[model samples]
Target chain A: MTAIQISVFLENKSGRLAEVTHALAKGGINIRALSLAETIDYGVLRLIVDKPKEAKTALAEAGFTVTETEVIAVAMPDRPGGLAGIVDLVTRHGLNIEYLYAFVGQRGENAVVIFRVDNAEEAITALQEGGAHVLSAAELSAI
Target chain B: MHETTPCWNREMEFMEEGHLRPLQSERLRDVVARVYERVPYYKEKLDAAGVSPEDIRGIEDIVRLPFTSKDDLRDTYPFGLFAVPMEQVVRVHASSGTTGRPTVVGYTRRDVQMWAEVMARTFAAGGTHIGDVVQNSYGYGLFTGGLGAHYGAELIGASVVPTSGGQTKRQVQILQDFGSTVLCCTPSYALVIGETGREMGVDFAGLPLRVGFFGAEPWSQSMRQEIEASLHVDALDIYGLSEMIGPGVSFECLEKGGLHINEDHFFPEVINPKTGDPVPDGELGELVFTSLTKEALPVLRYRSRDLTRIVTEPCGCGRSLRRMERVTGRTDEMLIVRGVNVFPSQVEEVLMRIEETTPNYLLVLDRKPRGMDEMEVQVEVSERTFSDEMSKLETLSERIGGEIEETLGLRVSVRLVEPRSLERSTGKAKRVMDRRDLGR
Candidate 1:
């Protein structure tokens, strides 16, 4: 609940990513972080951008199918135990992590790790109850 | 337009539409009565629906009868459609349902004769004279296409070279030695023969083949023209359904435009596929057939699922029996990939036009990570016109993709593979490999 993920379908051709980036850039939305999962013909561009709403709307207007999903952003120490502490908390709560990718926060020693877990809402609640600091969308987007 | 003689009576290939009506009427009446008395399946359906054999007066009254589906044949399994006993049944041919279980139909000697007559008429329509030898390449056995064409050639007094599919060298030898005048097989096989003949330096112009009757699967008109040009024969289209009658329902004459349905033997009705309502003339719809005169097995209004527009107007070939345009695709085979409807025949048409591509191709539909369908077309590049350059291959793929998108109204990734790269069966080429949600 502390973070959200958006998926963008892009054809696997030259300059397709550039086209998506230019559309979002012109709409004043910067990419905070992105990862691509590809097949033989096309790829799904998962983005944690500055403004998820504006970026998704811009991409949709550019003829891309975009879907938003809820995820968790756990702020942890940049040291080794920082990420381990959050994973340990989720494992303790009996929740499986479907996918996880992290990005550094804008102005803190703490790094924000994006976690797509089986139960995003329960995982967020349990992590907070376990003394973890979660970053807001605006606080994490400046990363 | 000058009316062609029903050609059904004069040409043994056809039973004239007019001549067939009374025979169909009598057969309908007899089958209903016989089925009511003998077959429990028929009796139960008729009785449950509060219908009686007396209600079926003629062929026109056929619409009132219940529709029989492939399920009906499968539900009964082996010999449910047979009007005769096991001892009376002579031979059997079946639907090649490779994905599931095949449906088998038993044929008595009379059924074979019916097949022979229809096939014979098929050859005669192509102007096959008695002395001509035919290089019959259609597969034999349960496929029905091979023996169906062979018997028809034999019935017309043409010496048949029983070259039952494959063995390219042997097929060519028979073509040259016996002077096979007419070729009968699927359009793809015919192209293979043409390619092999050229490789062996067989004279295309000097070959005895003047006519070729191609059917079994749906082929494009562009491919038909390619086959005609390659083999130097007046190519004709032969239409038949195994369920209704094996390979001689209707045929094309010297007029190579459309196929003339043997309306007398197989009365066709184009119906709205969704609602099952009758469609007006010249409209595209699912083709349904009522076997008016079949004895061993009579199927009433069995849906062929072949998408074609019916043309009742007489052809210039002197056949008044209605003709249908070449089948575009089957309703069952229509694939919805990425919200666009795609048919294998559409891609086939584009490939045939390229002249450098073989008829062999496979359509692979897979789900992308985003849960959307992606299509990949694997086409067999002709070895004769093979290109060595990567750029040429790229250009070929691009051109094919563009044409496919234009024709199918869907974007597809086209891959130009080497000759024989795609899988080929000895009988009936598999042109599509749809892998999108078959589990459901």
Candidate 2:
């Protein structure tokens, strides 16, 4: 029900993104899903990886300021209006989404979307009650 | 046991005004004639002004002589202004010049001794004594702060710990272990050391640090209070310029009233920056200095561009030397936004008063598309205050912007950056970034 997301504070300089990826590659860490939010001076690199503790230590050792956050993964119908339906349901339930990203599930029949909400537990309960499938941490990690 | 008076050289520091005036006149005449006879640059400038060495009869005629500016120094790059021959010149120092050619200064053996004497006076004014542990943290090499303080401490017979800026953690350790009685560096660097020391759980109040001499950059009174309270030391301000000499031109005595200028060796004048006329005493004006005893590189009425006023009123320290108020801003560094003048020091005062932010900030100036000047102050917040909550962040920004507007009388946009985002400098922090040219 709760997946750990690793976020990094990156200065918006040339080759910084490459440096992060290279550090992870050398550490044998694979990024499952990622999103980057940037401003003129700096950016935050949000990443979903297979190993949270290992990735955090490696990134920290590589001189990156890393933060571990809890996020919920929701499974949506692999159709035209899948994301739209989930968004409408969340909007109706009065849940706020800070940010989200989607990736195809291992089965290819459903799309798993990672949602970073203000309240992860409440968001998961509301989404489950709205008849959406929420993936557990172990299930997501296995995928 | 130290037997020297609180004033380094009792004879010179307490010299009566009558004696000082005649000494200045004699030294002024000798220096003017020396420059005119040896340096071709000064000879041409003096000839063009229709004045000669003989025309400079006394200190009163200093105004009649031509004024020298930094541009003139740049024009005569390496040795054009050295009055003494290369064989006679013993040492050389320079400004970083980050922008263009560095202004080079040469010193003969006597010139070096004169520098050391003024610095010694500065130390004594701050109540430094022989056998005291002096921690010199100002950067060394081409910059004068390091060597200037080093030589002065040695001349005063103080044990010199030439720590020379950086290694903040170690600086704190040494302050505790060495029992340093005096600290020397820029005020901002001192703050950095204080913050680092606190982070390392060093007990500054338990340390034996008695006095600190901070200079090489403009700082506000609020910053002084912060440094004094945090570092557990009496913070004193010292002023100088590489153009004339460094770190010993004037200093604050224990009275902490105003910096007593070493007028016997360097004559100071406050003048209207625009019209170049001497201002009445106690009126704010640009500072100008004429080196009366310098031999290697003598400046005649060199415009320091620092905005301050000279206080002829005698100080409580019993020294007859005239004191100049702490410089508020540089005439060249002042920014005009929407027809209102502002100095970075003013912004610094406002920012330091706010508890949520650190003193690290940058004033960015740009010309808007509507053809009006705009200013944006990018300030750094403490790690605890920086949050992902947009509302809270917005509120902090608005509060800072309002305070700046209330203090400086100008509306400015405030950007609260994360901790350590603004560039930090080991010496003379860069506080302003003029991006108006990018708009063009």
Candidate 3:
């Protein structure tokens, strides 16, 4: 089960991040979660928006370098050790997590976390075998 | 008292106008006759223009010869322009054309000898000696810059380091370890070398590197200052094209005022690009060259699209060869924005003078709804130039726009782009993007 994440290239100038958020807001698209990898001159803004396809199109129309990536979104308990239970399964299976970020305000009682692993299929299988509920693109977007 | 620079070929370089004119005339007459009889391309061009060998009796009558252009070179593909048999031709060089086939130039044995002498004179003018180590960084192979500079440095008795472009880190180490005295490469590569040296902690000012012969692309004077300051070497602008026998066609002497043409071998003229009439001396116009002594391929009044002014004033270096200002810009590269001429170099000169901006930039042209062609300069913002507020960045953009409009007298839009987004080309960098075709 893979969820799509929208990535936008943002120049490290003032009000650029705001412009991206403003464009998504204008398109009536909601951002679920975002992680900004910043450099000295520019930054890659990774967004897990509610509507990935429309977000990509809107941000691109706004003159941005946008790319859609598949990330594993797994549901887990909101407690601190509740996340370690899912992390231990992937670590025990030798799965490498490239990057991960947690966000609030999604559907269901459990919290949602986005995971970009080096090998997504193996990570999903290991997590599923460990009884972690993996969310699909539809289930995540519907939230 | 300090020692003065010496001429490589004293007899020819220091020849008085009284003796040099007739020599030039005699050679011009012979070459004109040779091309007329041998090369079918020149033959047809000359005959159509109602010109004959007798019409060109002296250097003053050079205008009688027909002008050959890149299109002419393309028409006569690979070996079409060779006046001599292929067996007699010693070497050939080619430059990639924007179209499919490349423009090829061939040189006979004697022609190769002439190239060596002129290139040697170029090095001599730069004060290169047998003791100095010359590191040649221009790319080797089909390109003429590498081999042209290689043969010239060898002819001048200097030890050669043939490190043809790329591996900039290795180049810096060679500069430090080999104790090279002279550096050769394009101005852009020189910047890369300086930056790479800083990264590697190589102190260029402490090294023995002295003079640099930079060419193969059009560069601004401010770039010279940047390279000189960074590499701690005196950078001299070398001018040439493959069609004109590569990088030795002309070179700036240590005097550094302008490049002196090897007039005895190659004749030069400044012409008004629009009317094709010879512009008076010291006036800006398109430059044209007519090879006086090339045997295998004798170019008769080859129209070099480079724009510059010629000065006949005496050079302090004691060479009688006429001087040309560093090429300002190419006539074809000139962009007409809403009826005004905009040069990419003018923008480069402006960017180089500014402290907050990097030289890597692109000029994009598009047509607005009212049919007005708009030009937007995409400038890469570095960390130091970047600000936390959007208004500050817009202010920087406005300042850039204001400065460019002040120089070109045309309003332009400035866009801030991410660093390293602009393409850094190994060869000639294409800076302008014309999207007007899509606009139309």
Candidate 4:
């Protein structure tokens, strides 16, 4: 249940976020979900786009430093404490969440949360056995 | 009052203007004859210009000679420009040749002695005296700065530290423990030391640094002010090139008005860069020099390409040697962006004034897809100013861009890089990267 995520290295300056988004839009790639981790000097922009390879190429060609990382997307009910339930399941299985962000399904039926963990395979299996719905790469991209 | 002045050679430094002109005229005549007779390159150029040693009767006629450029030196390669035979040459030094083939310079035994004499004069002009401790931090070997200063300090009987750049922490400790009174290095390296000392909790101002001889790169007045205040020392500018005889061509005395050229050894002339005609004193132009007494490498009417004015007014320090204003920029290094001239040093002046940015920066020039020139200035934000807040970072970039536009009269995109992202140099720092052809 692992998915591909595109991360870009960006200097903490004005119009940088817009530059990346504009490039993706011009490339006709849709960013389904995104999160940004930043420090004083630079930021890490993580993106879940429709076409990961194409988005990476477009951003790289536009002079952005980009990287590909594998993450797992967990599906949950679109209700209160939905993310908390997934976190509890991972914690009970002794799996740590490196980082996570959530987005509503395109159909608005369920909430899909993307997570980065130390061991993607173990997290996927544990979450699956814990009654969590883990979406495949195709399913995550479709949503 | 004259007895108290620390002039290495009072005769040359305080020569009367009337005597100075005759001395320069005699040396100029002798050097021109030597080059025309010994070096084929000078001979052919002089012959092609339809001029001979007989035609140059005085220093005034030096304008009639052909100008020698760095490209000429490069074309001749190693030892081609040497007037003396290889067996008579005693020393050799070369330019870094970051762009292409290195230009080599040779020195005879007398040339070495002359170099030592000028460097000693430079040291004394900066108020360094015997029994003082000197820390020579300019890079050693091939590069002329380190060994040039080393010999000069030794000639003056000062105790030399011989710490040849790098090792910032250790350099600070040595500065304090050794009681170094004289510092010699590029000004940027001096700033690096000051910043590193402050980070290490060392009070650089509390140290015994009385004077600094900084050169080998173009710097600004604001940088000098910052360095002087931070190190609590009188920061002086020294000018020279490897093509010339190292770091003793000229130096700032206590008057700090302008750098006094050792005109008795190196003749100075300011010429319009395009027209090749001498510009009147007090006006900006390209600086050209002719080695009056150099034995091995007697360059006749060598174009220095440095932009500055000649100051004939006698210095308050009692030196009659004509001084040249601080070099503003170089013709080769000036970038024409959208028909506006921009010098990296001007950008550096702006960056040094901003408290949030470090002096370390890179200028990238490229051609946009639409055939317009695009200039990007990559500056490293100080560790304290590096913030995750996009608004603060954007404000800093905007402020830098605005300052550059105001100063250089050209709009440039400012890219704020991480601290230490740009490469630091022990020798001359590479500041510009032209990628206009990469678009092709």
Which one wins on DockQ?
2
Q: Model 4, stretches more than 4 Å misplaced?
A: A1-143, B1-3, B335-440
lDDT of each: 0.77, 0.85, 0.85, 0.87
lDDT of 2 at B339: 78
| CAPRI classification of candidate 1 | incorrect
DockQ of each: 0.01, 0.08, 0.05, 0.06
lDDT of 4 by residue, A31-51 (tens): 999999876657778899999
Candidate 3's displacement at residue A50, Å, is: 34
Q: Which pairs of residues clash in candidate 3, taking residues 3 or more apart in a chain or in different chains? A: none
Tens-place lDDT digits, model 3, residues B92-153: 99886657789999999888888888889988888898989999999998899999999999
Candidate 1 regions exceeding 4 Å error are A1-143, B1-8, B11-23, B335-440
When only chain A is evaluated, what TM-score does every model earn? 0.88, 0.94, 0.94, 0.96
Give the number of the best model, judged by TM-score: 3
Sort order, TM-score high to low: 3, 4, 2, 1
- In model 3, state the lDDT of residue A115: 83
Clashes of 2: 0
Candidate 2, RMSD to the unseen true structure: 8.7
- The regions of model 2 sitting more than 4 angstroms off are A1-143, B1-5, B336-440
**Clash-forming residue pairs, model 2:** none
Tell me the tens digit of each residue's lDDT in model 2 across B1-440: 12333788888888888899989999999999899898899899999999988888888888898999999999999888998889999989999998899999989899889999999999988889887899999999999999988998899999999999899889888988899999999999999989999999988898888999999997767668889998998899999998888889999987888799999888999997877999999877789999988888999999998988998787777888899988867888777788776778678768878877888899999897778888999888654444433445567788999999998899999876656768874456788998786535
CA error at residue A40 for candidate 1, angstroms: 18
